[model samples]
Target: MMDPQIERKLIEIMRVIHESDKPIGARAIADELNNRGYDIGERAVRYHLRILDERGFTSKHGYAGRTLTELGEREMNEALIADRFGFVISRIEEMAFRTSYNPETNEGVVPVNISYFDKDDLETVIEIVSYTAHEGYMISPRVRIIEEDEELFSLPPGKIGIATVCSVAFDGLLLKAGIPVEPAYGGILQIENRKPARFSDLISYSGTSIDPIQIFMSRRTTSVLDVLEKGEGKILANIRQINLSAYERAREIMEKVEKVGLAGYFPPGEVGETLLGAPIETGKFGIAIVGGINGICALEETGIKIKTNPVSTVMEYKTMTEI
Candidate 1:
């Protein structure tokens, strides 16, 4: 592994070069570092820049300065990942302390609650919580195993439960629960309203039009899902319209919801290809759930219901179950 201080300086130097429009010299880099309160000297910066060049992270121009190579951009991305991991660790420590009592004083008490889950379940919770925090959501999750309880003799031996003290927003919870569902049903809402183009103009508009799943894509980030389009022109038009309409409609919807102060509900299958302006034959434009079973449960808890038929015919199962 590289020395931590050297790695940090290399990352900082790459950041300076990346942010600049043109190649920069060591002196300029040192100045930028100083501005950021790093107190780095020009000589030190030059030495690190040389190391970076040798490592293929940066390349020197004849007299112009040094510029970051593709490798350098990747290194900067790694640095960001490192920073996010550090933040997650710090948050986990804070949550642990907040949930647990002081061993010596027996003070620093929290609400009395109990949870039961197995080791696998705990791992799932941790994975979800870490992902949630990494995505810029605030989550203070507390989890503990229930080792022993005579009052719960009928329960499993190793039961664990988790609770979270978080901001009031269904977005984070939905994302977490949807993590396990396959072909997640979640998609962006495309709204079109000519009257209100911006949030400020929404006050003059009485109603809004929403088109769900105008651009349907899978929730998996591992690989890009192929875009199923009927004809080239149809797909292009759909993309262009949704891209423009979604933003305008979003502003109007938010404004209307705020003014009316009422929740809106839409049943499953209510939104179809006709509403989204896409042909059903394309097989690209239908509402489908992602994240597997856990995702379906999460959606149900949020007051949206779904129906599914088994893809396999070998086994008999319930045709429909309300989430």
Candidate 2:
């Protein structure tokens, strides 16, 4: 793999060329990159272009600058996605760090998953979310509701927003106690008799730019409603690994959070073992978290047109109300 710095410059240069009406020169590309806050000079731009040319991503027009080749455009598109890879993992860490909800007082901010649905579906939305909470499929029964025309994330016209406590609250709590957590992936976990069975699908956070849950939602793969009713089906879940040595401390924090009305997690599996069928590294144990978006998954199963941004933002615990 090329150095990240060089790769970024190459992608940007390709972008500038692709966006130009005519093949753009190294000087123009360098100037554009500079204006865009990159410290690249024409010499640097030319050096990067040679690399791109070697990769068949750009073609030199002699003194006419360079143009992105067919292969180059495709590579650029994939590179853009690659550049954003692990964004979900980064967001997870960011939100986890931002979380300050103390189990003792429960008065600090907690991470939340945001969803927007038609205002006309308010009655049904409430019913579904409440049912999910009752079924213990949500991170917490608490939720923050925003009516249309409210000052919040761009709520679409005629849409209302529902913010549910995210499972990352567990990560935050454990982290506050000095335990390191590595969120491995978001997956669809099979359930049996209301107990987690195994993961039937997974998307590792390290390889994806988009949240894995959103991808599963797009596929309409969750059987959250089925699991709620029949006690068997798949639901959105995430797997996180922690050092085996911190197991006891992590358990203590888990107990505290559960008492504060935030519930999500399976006890750690044995070191070097798989939990609910997801593999854990040799020196770590894995904890499976019930996804905070399970409630919304139920709503989607019911044929509601909803848009979701899981692990979107954080909100004060006190600001939300129990369903």
Candidate 3:
């Protein structure tokens, strides 16, 4: 009702006056607030207007209603131009909100901002497994979970990693085979083959204090595709681009492996394994996608890894130059 809230009400009232094409009287404003579920009395509204006048957010026009001052106009303009998160926190009072138990989608309509996380904040590591092609055997790719203090894993340099995430609480089933399970926000997740978890070449979600080794589970193919399309912010971007090139190279290299039937980094009994009869050609992607806007990011000795990030959505800003 009428408490310190009056000042807040005053700010709102001043803003309404500032934006209106027509001047509004005190009684009309009070009526509007009440209609909008605020229970302020007319007298209280009048008191607020006077305070607003002192603050220069509003001014009196002789016998007419108040109007916003230059300061008020500037503040209003700033509010209009604020970011989505900032606007919700600063201006919005209430909103619709909901959550689900599934992975691919979840949205909260309530007012809040996306927290900027640091490395020290994340202690638990979640990762997905990659199909490692051992020299002697052609085995299907499986998950390899490496926990804290665990011995580091050694794999061939050519494995690729990827992941998908669920917005809701997921059952732990999606995690890699040996990896220790971290406390998830939701429950254990069910990982159908459609939503297979893979290794990520990006590393945006990797926190600073994290173990050098990590992996994560991704959602379905569609979700993974979306994640890949958007790209991880840091290391992943480089890796994804490089991966395209690497795939082309791999096809070339694999073909040579077929032609010469060479083994190891070398070829043809006592000679090099490469089709060109040389060492494997290595291309470099500077960094892995590290997380920022969306998804998780992490880094490894070789390159970076990314989950999902906001890059897929292209937001074209209307530059001042346009007008």
Candidate 4:
């Protein structure tokens, strides 16, 4: 659990550090508070600093005073999101979403924001809550197989990924960045290097549906359906031909989507049985021709990312550009 008020205070401090481009001290934060007319004292600021340090949100540097952790920076972005950024990022995540880094030299984290919600579906929320890991469901994806980087963070739903980070910015590999598609949920996520391989060798992930059965039970299907019915986006769903080479195999699904024209087909077989998440089989991506169809949906299902700590999020309210 988190202290909401304290969290807000921490975010305020983090924003100060971010904008300053220099280490910020508790005294500095105190002065800023006073300047902002908060009526808070230095003692209160010290207390807040203690809490931030304990939570790894702030660290004691050698001589630079204190700084926000990778986690802290990501959390602060919620404050940084501009009023209309939601629309801007959505347009981006659609064209291409890639996560690439080398573990031997790079261990930075990319922050991305995804929106997960039960706000409109209490019945669905109830079902998912009481939901246990399915028997054959292995909620675990076999395709999430590039098993080398178990310590890296996985992309969860409702995340706004921040790109361009290095070891100086974080301690692990950076994965994603950008904004979210609206009717979005909240906050951004930090993804670490999910594999030990280099960018040149890592297999590229093409966003496609790997769960056919889940189409009925999962939140993604519902979300896609909602977007389609409301025409929120030109969406494509239940895309099969997963495990496809971004250049070739997935083309089949693309062709079908072309004919169906974003209606999202049911896809052929038992998808999750042999596959799930992003199965990084590594060296085995066979040669296949680029399939078909141009740009299709605004968002493609990557994989199900669960919460590390369920943070309360106010649904799509603004963007980084707007705020």
Best by TM-score: 2
Q: Each prediction's Cα lDDT score?
A: 0.35, 0.84, 0.30, 0.30
lDDT for each residue of candidate 1 in 162-197, tens digit (9 for 90 to 100): 332221111211222221111212233222231101
Off by over 4 Å in 2: 1-79
Which pairs of residues clash in candidate 2, taking residues 3 or more apart in a chain or in different chains? Answer: none
Tens digits of per-residue lDDT for model 4 on 1-323? 67666665666666555544357666766765553335677789878878878877777775556778897777666543442234223322322222232223333212222223222332342233222111111110011111212223222233322111111111011112221111111111111121111111112222211112122223332222223234232121111222322323333423432231111112222323322232223322221111011011112232333221111111111111110
- Separately for all candidates shown, the number of backbone clashes (residues 3 or more apart, or on different chains) is 19, 0, 59, 39
Candidate 2: deviation at residue 164, Å? 0.7
Q: lDDT (0-100) at residue 124 of candidate 2? A: 96
Clash count for candidate 1 is 19
| lDDT at residue 313 of model 2 (Cα atoms) | 72
Please give, for residues 1-323, the per-residue lDDT of candidate 2 as tens digits: 66787777787788778755457788878766664446889998888888888889888888877788999989887876766777578778888888898778767998898898888899999888988887877789999898765644445567789999998898898898999899888889899999988899998888887788789878989998898889999888888999989988988888877887888677778888988778889999988888898989899999998877777678899999988
Clashes in predicted model 3: 59
Ordering by TM-score: 2, 1, 3, 4
* 1-323 per-residue lDDT for model 3 (tens digits): 34645545665676557534456678767765653346787898888888777767777876657778889777654542322223221111111111111112222111111112223322322221121111111111111222233222111123222222211111111111111112101111111332212223322221212111122323211122233334321111111112223333433432443232111121111111221111212332211111121223222211233322211111111110110
Q: What lDDT score goes with residue 300 in model 4? A: 25
Q: lDDT value for candidate 1?
A: 0.35
lDDT of 2 at 273: 92
